[model samples]
Target: MTETVFQEESEVESLLSPLRSFLKCSTPKEWVEEAKKEKNLPTLLRDHLICELKAAQSAMLLIRRYAVDEESGKALLNWLKPYEDFTYRLVGDWRKLADYSSFNKRMVPKSRRPYSQPLIDKMVLLIKEELHHFYQVLEIAEELGIKYDKITSSRYARSLLSHVRTYEPAALIDKLICGAYIEARSCERFAAVAPHLTAKLSTFYYSLLRSEARHYQDYLALAREISDNDISERIAYFGEIEKELIQSSDDDFKFHSGLPC
Candidate 1:
C-alpha cells in the first residue's frame, strides 16, 4: 500500500513538473546564463523587475475593482502600502509583502453562490503566484542593481481597454475580455522575448508563459461564468479586437507594445 502511494505521488509530480516547466520556460537555466553574461544582467533584471511590478499592479487593480468592498479595500490599499512607498528604496524585506496579496479579506464577500468555483479558485491562485513572481523579479533586480522608477503608462494596456463597452455587466464582461487579451498578449510576449534574452531571463520569461496562458483562460472562464449564453460570441469579438491591437503600431518599447515604433 505504501509503495503504491509513493508511486502515485511520483506519477503526479512527474505530470505536474511539465506544467511547472511550461510556466517560466527554463528559469534555472536563465538564471545561470545571467550570471555568465555579467555585463547585461542589470538591464535584464531591471526589465524583469518592472515587469513583475506591472503584473502585481495588474492583479491589484483587479481585486480592487471586482473583489474588495469598501472597508477591505482600504485594508488592501494599506497592504500594498509598502510596495507603493518603496518601489525604489527597499525600506524593508520585500518578500514579506507577498502575504498581503492573497484572497483573504473580511470585507470582500465570497464568490457569488451560483458562480464558477473552479474559475474563482484558479484566478485567486493565479493572483497569488503572480504577486510572488513580482517579488522574485524585484529581488533579482536588487541583486543586479536596478532601481524601480515611476511607471509612465504603457500603450499596451490602453490599446486593449479601448474596446471595452460603456455599460454594466456588458462593461464588466468587456473588461474581463480585455483581461483575457492582456494575459494572452503577455503569454505571447513572454515567448517572443525569451530567445532574445540571456538564458536566465529567457528561462524566467518562458517559465511565465504557461501561467500567463492559463490567466487568459481564467478570465475567459469568469466572463462565461457570469453570462448564461454561450461565450463563444464574446470570445470571437475580443479576439478580433485583440488581434487589431497586437498587429498595430505603437511608440513604447516596453514588453507588450506593438511593432517597434
Candidate 2:
C-alpha cells in the first residue's frame, strides 16, 4: 500500500483505540457479517437513519431538560421538528431537512450550574452534526432505492438505559455514560462493517469515525464534569453492562444488535 493509505489506516486505529478500551468487548464477528450482507443493506441503512435522529434527539433532550430555558427549549424543538416529522409522523419532505438543522436561538441556561454551559455547548454541536448525518444517510438510502420504513428500535439503548439510577445528577450521569457506550459501540461497528461494504459505503462509514469518536468523549467528559466524586467506578459499572448487550444473543440484527441467535 502507498504511504498515504497506510497513514489513513493508522489514523483510524488511533481514533478507535480509546473507544475499544472504554467498552468491554468489540462487536461480535457474527454481527458484522450479518450487517454487511446485500439483503441486509436496506435494514442497515434504515436503522442507521433512525439511529442518527435518535442520537440528535437524545442530545436535544439533555439540553432542554437540564440547561435551556423555556424559549430556547422551544427553539430546540423547532430545529428538530422537520426531522421528527419525517421520521415518525412521515409528514415532511426529507429532502428539505437541511433547512431545519440550524439553531439560531440563544440558549439561556436554567440555572447557575457550572456544567450547564458545557453540556449545552457540546450537545448542541452534536445535535447539528447528527442531524446532518441523518440527511447523509437518507441521501445514500435514496441512491440505493432503499425506501424509508419505520423499523422497531433495537433493545440496545433501552436496555442500557434501564440501568440508569432514578435520581438527580446520578440519573443524568448514568444516562451520559450510557450515551458514551452507545456512541463508542457505533464507532466500533462502523469500522468493523466498513470493509465488507461497497467502496462508497465503506468510505462513508470511515468518514464518520472522527466525529463519532469525539461524541463519546464529549459524553464521558460531561459526565465527569457533572459528578462531584470520581466517576471511574460508574464508568466501569456500565462498561460490563454494555459489553453483555453487545456479546449476548439477539434475534434482532440491527446496527447495534448483539450476536445473531
Candidate 3:
C-alpha cells in the first residue's frame, strides 16, 4: 500500500515538474510533515479557503486598479459584492458567491495597450476559478464540521508582498511574479498533504492541483508579456525572496508557512 501511494505521489510530482522548475526551492520536509498531521487539516482547510478568497480578491484588485475604467470598476465591485458579503458581513448566503454569470460587456480599459485585454481575461478567469475553489472549500469545511473561524495572515504572503516595487510596469511585474509564487506554493502544498488526508479530502485537493498549476503559468505568462526587457533577472530575484521565506523560520503553522520556529 505504501509503495502504491508512493507511486501515485511520484506521478503527481511529475505533473508538478513545471512548477518545480519555476520555483526557486522545494517545500521543506519539516513543513510537509507538519502539514500532513491529521490534527492540522481543519486549520489548513480554513486558511486555505481564506487564501482562495484572497487570491480572487488579489486578481480583482489588479483588474480594478490597473485595467478597469470607472464604470467597469463599479461592475467589478458588484461582481465581488456577494463574495465579500459572505466573507466579511456574513449577511448573505455562501451560494451567492457561487454565481459565475457575465459582468458588463463594456469592460473599457484605461489604455488600449496590448497587455490590457490579456490581463483582464486572465485575471477574470482566475477570479472565477479561485471563487469556485473558495466555495468548494466551504463545502469541505461543512462536511468536516470545521467552522469558518478567522485566521491571522501568514508570514509567507506578507513577506513577499512587502517587496513589491513602487513604480509602474515594475510594480505590475512584481505583483505577477508574486502571484505565480503563491499559486505554485499552494499547488506544492496540496500535493504534499493530499496523501495523508481522508480519501474525500484527498480527491478534492488533487482535483485542484491542475488549476492551481495553470494559475501560476498564467501569471508568469502575463508577466513576460507585459515586460519590455527580459524578466529573468526579476524572476530570479523574486525566487530568492520566496526561497528565503520558505527556508527560514516561521511562528505560524498556517498553509504555506515555513518550518515552525
Candidate 4:
C-alpha cells in the first residue's frame, strides 16, 4: 500500500502542478485541521455528497435552460430522478444509489447561438461526471457507516450566486464564471484535505483532482467563448468574494464552509 500510494501521488503531481497555478487562493490551514478530525468525517461526507448532486443539478439546469430540446429535457429529468429521490426524498438506500447510473447523450435543439454546441457538450460531460462522483461518495459513506442527512447549505455558493448579474448573456457569463470558481475551489480543498485523511480516503480525494481541475477549465473556457467583453474584472471581483468566504468565520464545518468557529 505504501509503495502504491507513492506512485499514485507521483502521477498526480503533474495534474496538481497546473491546479496550483489556476487559483488565486488556497484553502485555509485552519479549515484543514478542523476537517481532518475523526468526528467531522461524517459531516464532511454528507456535505460532499450534497455538493456532488448539486453540481450535477446545476449543470443540468444550464443545459435544460439553454441547450436541450423538449424530448432531451425530459430524458434529463429521468436521468436525475433516482439520484434526486435518494438524496432528497430518502426513498432509496445506499444499495439503490450505487446501482443508479447512465445519462442520455442524445443531442437536440439548443437555444440558438454560435457557441451552443460547445456549451452543451461540455456541460453534459460535467453533469455526467458530477453524478458519478455523487454515487462514489455515497459508496464511501456507506463503507464508513455514515448515513446521508439533510444539511443546511453553507453561505459559500449562495453568496456567489447572489452576485450574478440580472441581464441576458451577462447573467449567463457571470453564472459560468461562478461555476468555474466553485469547481476550482473544490479541487483546491480536495488536495488540501487529502493528505490528512486515512489512506483510502486520501486516495479517493487525490483521484478527483484531475476531473475537478478540468471542470473549472471547461467553465472558464465557455465563459470566455460566450462573453462580448473582457470578463477578467468580473472574475477578479468574484475571486475576492470567494477568498473571503473561504477565510471567514463559520460555525458550520461543511465541506465548503469557511474557517470553523
Candidate 5:
C-alpha cells in the first residue's frame, strides 16, 4: 500500500477502536461474509437505503416528540415529505432528492425544557445527514444498475426498541441510548463490509465513518444530558442486548441483521 493508503487505514482503525469498545461485541464474521457476497449486494443496498431514511425519520420523531414546537414539528414533517414519498409511494424522481435534504426552518424548542435545544440541534443535523446518505445510497445503486425494491425490515431495531421503558423521561432516555447502539452498530458494519466491496463502494462506506461515529456520540451525549442521574447501568444493559442481537443466528440477513442461519 502507498503511504496515503496506509494513513487512511490508520485513520479508519482510530475511528473504529472506541466504537468497538463501546459495543459489547464486533460484527460477527459470518454476518460480514454474508453481507459481502455478490448476490447480497442489491438486498444490502436496498435495505441500506431504507435504513438511512428510517434513521432520519427516527431523528425527526425525536425532535417532534420531545423538543420542537408545533410549527417546527410540521416543518420537520414537510422536510422529510419528498423522501418519504419516494421511499413509500415511489412517487418522485430519486435524482431530484438532493435538493430536498436541507431544512432551513427556525426550530423553537418547548419552553422551560433546558435540554430541548441540544436535542433539537443534534437530531436535526442527524436527520439532514441521514437523508443525504439515503440519496447517496440510491445514487450508488443506480450506478451499479441495481433497481430499488422494498424489502421487509430486519428484526433488529424492533427488538431493541421493544425494551424501551414506557414512562416519560426514562422512556426518552432509553430511546436515545438505543439510538446510540443502533448508530454504533451501523458504523461497525460499514467498516466490516467496506473492505470486501468494490473500490467505489468501499470509498463511500469509509467516508461515512466519521459522521456515523459522531452520531452515536451525539446520541449518547443527549441521553446523558437529559437524565438527572447516571445512566451507566442502563447503557451497559442495552449493550448486552445489542450484542446478543448481533451474535444470534437469524434467517433474515439485512444490513443490521444478526448472524445468517
Candidate 6:
C-alpha cells in the first residue's frame, strides 16, 4: 500500500529468495491465528524497547573499540552522552525533543586510524541508524507510559560481541560483520513478529523505516569491502555463531536472543 511496503517487499524477496526455495511448507497456521489477538502489541513493544537499546549499545561498543582513536573514542562517547544520560540518568522526553543529536562535529583526524572510504561511510550509516532506532524506542516508551529502568547488559549482546575478533582491521571487520548478523536477525524477527502485533504497532514496525534494512546491508558491505578475499567464509562463520546464539536458550531475553528464555 505504501512505498515502504513496496521497498521492503522487494528487498525481502531478494534477500529471502534463496531460503524460500528450501521451504516446503508455508507459514504455520497457528501464527496466522495468533495474529488476530490484541495484546500482542504491548508485549512486543516492551521487548522492542529493550531490543532497541541493546542494538544501539552494540554499535556503540564496536565503534568505540575499533573505529576510532582515543580522541575519537571520547567524541563517540560524547555523541552518546545524552542517550546514556537519558537511559541511565532519566532525562526528559526525547520524542518531542532531540537535545543533542547533531553529527556535525564528527571528528576523526586523518593521521589517526585512517578509515577506508567504504568503512567510514558504512559505519556512519550504522551509527545514524542505531541512534535513530534509540529515539524511536524512546518515543514509543514515552507514549506507552513504560518506565525505563536500568538493567545490566543482556546475554544476547554479550554473546554476539564475544565472537568479535580482538585485533585491528580484523577486529573492525569482524565486528562490522557481527553487527550485520545482529541487524539481519533483528530485521528477520521484526518481520516475524509484525504479523502478530496490533494494527498500530504492526504498522509502525512495518513502516517505511529505511535505516534498519540499511544497517544490515551496510555492515555486510563494510565487512566485504575490508576483506582481502571473498567474504562468504567469514559471513558463514558469523552466521553460524549468530544462529546458535539466537536458537538456544538463555537466562535473559532481549532484542537478539534465539527464543524465549
Q: What are the per-residue Cα lDDT tens digits for candidate 1 across 173-261?
A: 78777777677666655654566665666667766766777777777778887776786777677676665555566554455544444
Q: Which stretch of 10 consecutive residues in model 1 shows the poorest summed lDDT?
A: 22-31
Model 5: per-residue lDDT, tens digit, 1-261? 999999999999999999999999988899988987999999999999999999999999999999989999999999999998988888889999988877889999999899999999999999989998999999999999999877899999999999999998999999999999999999999999999999999999999999999999999999999899999999999999999999999999899999899
What TM-score should be assigned to candidate 6?
Answer: 0.76
Q: What Cα-based lDDT does every candidate model obtain?
A: 0.60, 0.93, 0.86, 0.85, 0.94, 0.61
Q: lDDT, candidate 6, residue 253?
A: 41
Candidate 1: residue 120 lDDT (0-100): 37
Candidate 2 lDDT over residue span 49-95, tens digit each: 99999999999999999997899999999889889989998998889
TM-score of each: 0.70, 0.98, 0.92, 0.93, 0.98, 0.76
Cα lDDT for residue 23, candidate 3: 85
Q: Output the lDDT of residue 259, model 4.
A: 84
- Give the per-residue lDDT digits (tens) of candidate 3, residues 1-261: 699889877878776998899888888988888888878888898889889989988998998888878888788788877777777766676655556434545678787677878989999989888888898999888888887777777988888989999998999999999999999999988888788888998999998988999999999999999999899998889899999999999878998898777
Tens digit per residue, CA lDDT, model 4, 55-95: 98888888887777888878888888888887788887757
What are the runs in model 1 whose C-alpha is more than 4 Å off?
1-51, 58-60, 88-113, 116-120
What digit string (tens of lDDT, one per residue) describes model 6 on residues 1-261?
A: 999789868975665453333222233333333433444344445566656655666666666665555776677677777776666667755553365565665646334554544454566556666677667766765676765666555566567678878776787787777777666656655666666665655666655234566677777777776677787777777766766675565555444444443
- lDDT-sorted candidate list, best first: 5, 2, 3, 4, 6, 1
- List runs of model 5 lying over 4 Å from the truth: none
Residue 9 accuracy (lDDT) in model 5: 92
Record all residue pairs in model 6 with backbone atoms less than 3 Å apart, i.e. clashing.
246-258
The deviation in Å at residue 80 for candidate 6 is: 0.9
Q: What is the lDDT of candidate 5?
A: 0.94
